[model samples]
Target: MTDFDQFEDEDDTPKSKTQIKREMEALQEIGKKLLQLSKSQQKKVPMSDTLRDALNEADRIKQHEATRRHLQYIGKVMRSEDHQAIEQRLALFDTTSAAYNKLFHQLELKRDALIGENSKEELANYLDEHPEVEDIQTLRNLIRQSQKEVSQQGKTTNRKKLFRFLRETEEKRLGLAE
Candidate 1:
């Protein structure tokens, strides 16, 4: 049997002092290494485009790995009959939805900052030229009303397809497939 199996089968037998000490030392070493890595990463700011690109690639790889693992877990859940699998899938869906929401919020913040920094005429002209910017209804309405007051607009705004796949995926996850 595995070590975990043996441990689970046993009664309230406390771990041996030596085992406890060894585990504690191992954890301490892990903690030390984590601290050292954090310190080094903090100190090593990228000074060149190459280093920045390398860091971006590393981050992309890490995110891809995480997404792969999450997909594997979902696939495993799909194959299993356990109720826990349903719960796990729901939890994963919630996490994915929250992440997307956070991303959209950050994008909205950036868009707002850009609009705020520009002059009224400049912002209206930009909105007229980039009609897709109005696809975000709330932002679009705000810009539309503001444009009316300024009257130095250029052209009409139009909606563009955005987050359509994400919406469909979310719908499927919630069992509201259409």
Candidate 2:
């Protein structure tokens, strides 16, 4: 007897390969018909605004799901036991962090330029333009007050220097005469 006959006898239930393929194809066609019927029913149903919003949200969620899968793939790559893969992932992380820091620093510099210097006029103008910076007024006032004090002190020191020079010259002339 052939191996096929040895595996199955007349009493056994036997399905030919062609019969199995045809059955599978028939089931697939039925599934497609069912899917089409469901789709037609869905089209017939009226969509409410809330349902439309929910569907939009669902689309956004699906997009995020795709992103999550991509992140998982990256995680898997990072989690690889291979030394080269781990090192590559770590290098990528470091490079990304450095780039972020550089970009942040550049943004900070731009923001600082917008704020301008600590000059009183600049501060006042900025405060006038951006009322949200009211908290900075106190610090600005302090800076202005300190600057005034320093200017006053400088004038006093200059006057003192002139006075001392005049007094010294007079003393030197008096000594020459004596």
Candidate 3:
């Protein structure tokens, strides 16, 4: 009916106080999860130096009230960070995450190929593709062991070792290894 009323009607609605509080709580929960991660795991997640320092401090705080306050500070710091990127990296550490499962399956397939009937050619191709493979001899040895076990229908101890080696190689390639 008046100029003020018209301006209010045209303005976009701001977030309600309750909405803001809920969002803050969600970020705090994320901070709590980050704190739960080991030091090595924390390094994998991309974060600003300030946030990293805050997390480190949070780790040292043992008193109940001080720890609680520091967690809130962490939540504040996390507000300025890329939540999605942090979550994606964190999900890599979770075995149930789709990304983790996909990587695991791919490694399994590669390991199987390396120990399969066509392993000689597959190993050659794999080495060519991943020239960064540090210990070619060890990889070949493991593959050979796994192949022998498969042919004899024996327990797959070497196959497991081969899979583990492949996983370690992948982690190093991805810069997730120490």
Candidate 4:
């Protein structure tokens, strides 16, 4: 048989050089996406400890060319990981996802509950449940300020602050904080 005929008879066909390059580029893009995620967001993503270290190291590199080289290294590390799983977790961060919306509303509800009519009891219970809250006085003050804003038709600055505090507390509790 001719060389071309023998090659065609093989069950496994080799990918073209262009196709291999495209795949490597795709993986590199995935690595870039992982780098773009915030540290808090990265905590939620599933990846090897090695890959995580590589990405963290990339964060410390300030020069453009050094960062580019680190990105390529991250891409290489990503090759051994389950990229699909990483992408799935990343998708949860999208605002349109039901999971994202649910967590957001839950945090808002907790914020409102803290500032509700029975705020004293709510605050007590919340503190008991989340001992990670280091500054109880600040939390109490924010709740009081939020309550005042709601009663006096003031701007929602304090309410927003209270919500942020609650969100950060939750993140710390879940080990998702930066």
Predicted model with the maximum lDDT: 3
lDDT of 3 by residue, 1-178 (tens): 5312322323666556666667667778888888889999999888999999998888788899998888788877777799888887777788889999999999999999988889889999898888889899999899999989999998989999999999988888777787
Per-residue C-alpha lDDT of model 1 across residues 1-178, encoded as one tens digit per residue? 4332322315767677677545444433322222223323423321234323433433344476664453333332222223243333333334355654664564444344334436355556645655544244555455544444335453333111122322333344444343
lDDT (CA) per prediction: 0.39, 0.39, 0.85, 0.82
Candidate 4, superposed: residue stretches over 4 Å from native: 1-46, 53-92
Clashes of each: 0, 0, 0, 0
- Misplaced by over 4 Å in model 3 are 1-19
Q: The CA-based lDDT of model 2 is what?
A: 0.39
- Give residue 113's lDDT in candidate 2 (0 to 100): 36
Model 3: weakest 10-residue lDDT segment is 1-10
Q: Which candidate model has the greater TM-score, 3 or 4?
A: 3
lDDT of 2 at 124: 60
The C-alpha TM-scores of every prediction are 0.21, 0.20, 0.80, 0.60
- Candidate 2 weakest ten by summed lDDT: 74-83
Model 2, span 1-178: residue lDDT tens: 5323432436887667676545444433322222223333323223334433332333344376664453333332222223343233223224355643554454344333333455556546545755543346444444444455455664444333323333333323323111
- Model 3 C-alpha lDDT versus the unseen true structure: 0.85
